[model samples]
Target: MNSNNDVIRKLHELTEADMSEAEFLQSVENNMIPMQQFFTYYRCAIMEIETKFRVLNEQFSLNGESNPIEFIQSRIKSYGSIFRKIMTNHIPRNVEAIERDINDIAGIRVVCSFVQDIYRLADCFLRQDDITLIEKKDYINNPKPNGYRSLHLIVAVPIFLENEKRLVKAEVQLRTIAMDFWASLEHKLRYKKDLPPYQLNLLADDLKKCADQSAEWDRRMQDIKNILESN
Candidate 1:
């Protein structure tokens, strides 16, 4: 069996030399253990972040406050997707480089009940001493060109191992329930390759209109909640 460093070095060589996909797969097959271990660290980091949000939700319940979080979803990027990213972006071909450049190896999506809850949960998560904020993109305030909206955060959290503690990066996306619903449908429709160009354009326009309406709904719901709280 190759040592971890040896496996990393071999993989780096294979990627850097632009080996055939079959050759790369053979190398990966021979050295699956180390690669799997690398991704496992990211999984641990996701668990740590998820636990923090779960605890916060539980605290709100205990205090008779409305739970802000509706649901939490987490995923680790597949190896094939990671490889495509490395090749597409001309990233450095090494384990260290991949870890450094890929911010979303592990991801957590937190769906909140209201727009306000998105920022509230983000603030609470970032305020913790153990979590380090690496980057933040407020797409909710400034929607993307396609009218997508979400609060994206790239954070580093320490994951404890039996022998060492590793700080891994994971992306946290906070969005309102309506926003999530809109995004889910948009993603599904946008990926259909069979759609004609004209139809695609029309679909895109409709999606943008829907996004605007959903955002307005979120605002009105939040206002009603504020009124009730004031009573």
Candidate 2:
């Protein structure tokens, strides 16, 4: 694998220096194997993290506590998306560079029942010794200008291969059910290329209002849950 990457690095250097289309294609073909290997490692890391969440949910059930996590979704970035990012970011065309820079190449979305549940689950997950927190963005508290609300965490987990233990990074997005619903709709509508600028602005404003309402709903639901627990 090392020899293959070394060769690929040389090819990448040539490509940077304006290699022909045939040479570029050859470099891509050579990169395919190592790229797939890196993706496999990322998938393994996702499995490890998902299993941890599942265990946490089960423990909550066993202790007569409602499960915090509603559902989990995991995915690897598609080749087209990866290539677009590499070109747009001017990143080195190598597996190592991609693995180091593309933190969201492997992603896991965890939707919870309430706002508090999101934080609770995150704290519990991060407390584990093996899970390394690389970066955190608290969008729930400090939402985006478009009113997006979610806790984004870039975490590293060790995936044991046949002869090596490699640490892989994955982005974990935690949000409440309401927030997720609003985000899903917003995402679907945001990409309507047919919409004119004025219409798009109007749609954005509506989505922002909806996001605020969703956040309020989450707060109310959390308060009710707290009241019930206190009783």
Per residue, candidate 1 scores C-alpha lDDT tens digits across 115-147 of: 888998899899999999999999999999888
C-alpha TM-score for every candidate: 0.86, 0.86
lDDT by residue (129-151, candidate 2, tens digit) is 99999999999999999999999
Collision pairs in model 2: none
Q: Give the Cα error of residue 54 in candidate 2, in Å.
A: 0.5
- What local distance difference test score does each model get? 0.86, 0.83
Candidate maximizing lDDT: 1
Model 1 TM-score, 2 decimals: 0.86
Model 1, residue 112: C-alpha shift (Å):
0.5
Task: State residue 43's C-alpha deviation in candidate 2, in Å.
Answer: 0.8
